[model samples]
Target: MMFDKVIAAVDKKLERFDPIWQAENGVGGQRDRYYDKTGVAKWREWRGVKDTMVDYGAWLKNLASMAMMVASAPIPCLKGFWEYRWMGSYLGTFMFIDRLFEGFRGYELVTAHKCMHAIVRSLTKKIAFCLSNDRRLGGGKDTDRIVPMDEVLPPLFMMGFKELVPFPLQTLPEFIICDVDQHIEPYYIDVAESFGLPADVCSRCAAETGVALDDAFPLIGKAMISTNMPCNASEATSMFQRRRIGMPDFPVTLAMIHNEPGAHPYSTQMLKDAIAFVEKEYGVKYDWDNLFKYAKLMNEQNTIELEKWDYFKTPYSALCGIAETLYRLYAWASVNGTDPYFNKVDRQVIKIMRKAYEEKKEPFGGRTRHRAFLWGPSAVYYTDFPTWIQNCWGINIVLNMDSTMGHNMINTEDPDEAIKDLALFSEKATMRHHAVGGWDNVNAIWEWAKNFNCDMVLMNDNIACKGMLGVHALMEEQARDLGFHFIFIEHDLEDCRTVSRQDMRNCVNGYMSVVLGEEPLDPTLVEFDDSDAY
Candidate 1:
């Protein structure tokens, strides 16, 4: 049921200090000896002697020893030596980078630890990879040694740590449940049971109760029973079979596109249409232009040049962009789906919002900020990829998708097939999905969304097939009770070019209007019409 073994391993080792930690905290005071005039002179002389050497191995060894000393030194002393604000901070940065690179490369912890030793070795290696490749360095004869720690560290750290931590843990929970709803009650109960907790104790109990159930007691009872005991003996045996053989063959009817890089004009239009529909239906006035302006400002602040909205250039920047996009997408979906739940769960939120706004009373009867207490669809989830690049650079673009619709989509469907489509989109920009039984596999997604407080679920309605649409309708109804903002955008997985510039603007603007309570702006003003542009 749970990755208990992995959790146990992490829990056990989490408390133990690595060499870096021990060196920083325990041996941080040894830097004075190195800082002394004599010590400085000795190091300088060593550097001078090393610079004159033609032997690469000797140079490498010397650097390795120095790096080892630096890595193993007390955190405070290391800081003073580097004249940085904090020694521990510097070591922490290096260790983080080392771990991240290791994770990105899919190295196990032990393997990563060993690789850290190798990096330390390379730190000492005088021949830089960059220098090795430089024609100006006179091919292999160049003796110049340099360390571009900054350039190398970020990608390594960014990629490695994400890999080390399974995608599910880092991003799940958040995206699975955008807003709470009735249809997802069973899923919530199951999750609670998995954690050995009572369903009543689950965070979204309020929403789950909306479902027509014979008795709430059974929910708690089932969870309690499942907690301390395994399933029946036959079921346990079946579990093994399930683990080894997986489910029966099911045709994939839906294609999930991953990392669909091109302009998202359709997404933009969908958002606009959704906003217009919601506003007209709900009688809510919004400021769409202002919202888009804010989005543009945010994009600029994050250094995402609208002119260069092609493939994500850097990992960090890519993550930032993805996070922004997913956040807005989720917001739009939740808002558009609000009509379904308008008389049900959403009214409760509105009541809360009004009370907080006018009466200054908290919603959910909590003392948190008014904004914090205003609940909607929100959860965290994770995604997986085959290659390290997909895992690192590509996946990060939607790091917060779990907190968005991405999590819900995966949970509701065959994750393998969904992932396959996602990957295809990343590589070739195409996707397809096969059905499982009568369900759309997106049930998992809906369940997760309900857990998170999503009343309306947002999904990528690429094909709009009957089965998939049925799933959406069911989710929409459930969201009405749970109070979701449901919305879906259409686009082909294969055609990255299908996402036009206008679509991107409309999507961003419309989503912002819904989430931020603004108007839907005209996408025509955004100038996304250029077809030849990236």
Candidate 2:
């Protein structure tokens, strides 16, 4: 009885530090949950009893997915863990997920988990598939059935090859893993530098080159397809990768300034040539029926995506932040209508979004002080920046530049028309259109912000992105003229070693506190050490 009373007394005294209580009052001491300088929280965040149960259930679901990954190919997965450095980095996934949706509740909580679990389930399956067939891990029966392709290329069009699995090769070793564990890529980057690659190259490109040089990528596919869609750096890295992999590779160079009508024919022909190359190498005919089946799925997914954008323009979107961007990036680029599961997830999420809108419930319990459009490529290392900003400040990230990738509806019938549509869609791939396609595309940020009804633009200034380097003054001047609140959050894209997560937060902290003269909703988040954290 005395112990119970003592516990109650202490809880009452420390109510200010209780995340659940602080959440209700709109001034959370969220930092109290963490041990200093680490991602480790002393306890799981206490959403109210109901939401807590939901969160715990979601955690269990993810655990099950991880277990299945190991079970699918026990020996291969074991070998993969031992042979691949990036595979071990996946151990931080649960922690990374925990941090992704820290302050979520009610509809947002449920919606985020639905979207996240879809990715989680899909990723685990992909990991198993890769490990099982990986030639590097003692090639299985299905090794030659894989068609390794550039991660940036939308693999949707590759569905025409019904017999083969078109895998985004770099996604396993470099891209997605970087989002989970920030420290993993730095070693690869160092490997590339040691191999005579300059240190000043884009970290994304450098890390990919390093992954190639380190021979960490799974050996799969009879022939590989590389692309020059996103940038020159990516093209350069493709050369390095092609040499390292020693595979018969075809480079699909899409037109850079792709918006012009003239560029379509060139890009379409390139796609046709690439398809021909694949058909010749793999000895499999292209099947339009197979392509159309997946095309319809992509079309419906995109239609729902457009409808979701309408909700984003309103103040009542159930989905926002990393939950919105990360899912779109993965679904659009990686999965790309290849799976029916994502479409089902999207349907469920949209229903919840509609209900939330109908109820007029805003995310973060209506504490949103600014509805901002996050422009430029966000830091992969700090994927939860959106969640952090919402919890620490009242700024709701309404949209992200990456999410604005190719939404054009493809023709569900007619092979010729569909090929053209695919080319057009592929032209606007992630970071390709906005970051490096042309000056007009880069300058379209203001129009996008206005269309989305955003009051502020949080421009991600990737310090080493050569494409965006010279636009700093122009963007600032334009923001001033347009009368929208803008702040440039600078970070080295894939390399947190250059600009730490704290440095990125400090960028927003200075702008929020000094310029806006607004105090943080959770002041404890303003300055903290997560440098040593996963």
Candidate 3:
């Protein structure tokens, strides 16, 4: 009971300081904005709902959310206190952390599940990526087959499997968006280095290579599905793993379009064969009717997405586009195809935007000075850049490559036809649409920008994806040719060491000030200092 005089003295001093913050107008509490008696009851109601969830993990998630919500209550009343005005950034960080760790506590994580096929580690990276991410991004219930760039995967479900996972990778959008890859991947990269992986190989691939080489990713799923899209990192992983890590052999079904005449049919047959492979291997039965069910749902989602994209095209939101763009990339192609979440969110989005469209309102609320579109991969490494731009110098990213909803409509008139249609539809997903070389290759970028009324092109060069890097100059020239300014920054979508976050900010700020002729709020970021340490 004998407390030190020093403690007593500090406690008295602390109470005096605390009163200032707790003085009704202080940062001590924001309960007035978030809760009245009714609101408190509402929170309890949600707490009760969470109590009914079958999974214990829901409890942890709910508690975390509750903490975040409470922590954010002051945000609405931020103007009441100058010190609390930057609540958006703090709340944003919490949301980012929550999104990053969504499924880790729920199911036997996608990375931990067991699979029974010979996965070319190259192809399986997409599989592994989607499996781990499907639950969080798409609201997808299960992972049945790994389908790349196809809205037509209900066929596999029809065969008997519960869920079919789709890979929309040209760049790993999910991992990049999560940015937690930076935490888990560095160790894996070290493992790859120890295993004698090449230095010049893209860090994205190299990091995934680290995952396989260390046997860190749990081998799960019935079979591996991939397309012949030249993802060098995946190839490097597969080729190198064969020489080293000795991953369990699994059957790989490579879905490709060798002939334009029979391409649809070929994709359909390949998918059907893949269904057979999984049924034979995983012992899961496929339900043919699910094909039509998912097909209808996906079609509905596509329409909603188009409507949402129309809202995006308008200047309405003051939000930094990068974080929003990342979520859209996850939601639009991947999750929208899987569940009703996207449609529900789209309805809310449309509601908010309808007023804007009708009133002829600017989405950025006059904050946007530059209307930009992202090229190549996004800067997942410095995801805050978009927000920084918004806070520092109001730039609106009107469109992200992943957010493009072009040509995703699939015919559900016939499920069999839907199979081919959706399979091919998925083939045209974000990175795949442009990454797969042909007439539309780089030209597609121009075509998309022409529609969006973009003011400038912000290319986030993921140094890891060299294929796109090879044509960097051509795309930049095209952007200029379109009479729009082009600014390219060399930054990885995943790894941070290549270009530190502040430097990435500096590069973007420099471009904004110099090339775009916009004054930056933090002009210090516009300078280039090569001597700076990563």
Highest lDDT model number: 2
lDDT of every predicted structure (CA atoms):
0.26, 0.89, 0.47
Predicted model with the maximum TM-score? 2
TM-score, predicted candidate 2 vs. hidden true structure: 0.96
Candidate 1, position 434, lDDT = 21
Clashes of 1: 87
lDDT of 2 by residue, 68-118 (tens): 999988999999999999999999999999999988988999999999999
Per-residue lDDT of model 3, residues 1-534, tens digit only = 344566556555554233122322344321222232211111211111122232234334434544543454333223312221112222233233322222121111111111000011122233334434332222222343443332212222332245554443322322432242333445556678787876667665676667556543332333444333335455555555444434222222234332244555655676667667656655666665666666666667667657756766667532225544655555544454455544554455555556556766664235467777766453542344554455356566666776653345666556576667655664455455555434355566766766777777777776767667677778767876778777777776555666665566677767766766766543322332322111
lDDT, candidate 2, equals 0.89
- Cα misplacement distance, residue 159 of candidate 1 (Å): 21
Provide backbone clash counts, one per model. Answer: 87, 0, 27
lDDT per residue (tens digit) for residues 1-534 in model 1: 356576546544632222222222443211121233111211211111122132223334435655655454334233333331112222232322221221121111222223233333433221132223222223332211111111101111111111111011001111122111112333434543464543222222222221112111101100000000011221232232223232221111121221233323332332234334434433444443333332333223223222112221211121122223323333222221112221232223233333334443321122111110011112211111111111111212212222222211111133333333222221211011121123433444445443333333345443312334456567657656656454444422112233332353344345445664543121112222322211
lDDT of 2 at 470: 86
Q: How far out, in Å, is residue 286 in model 1?
A: 62
> Candidate 2, after superposition: displacement of residue 158 in Å?
0.6
Task: Point out the worst 10-residue segment of candidate 2 by lDDT.
Answer: 375-384
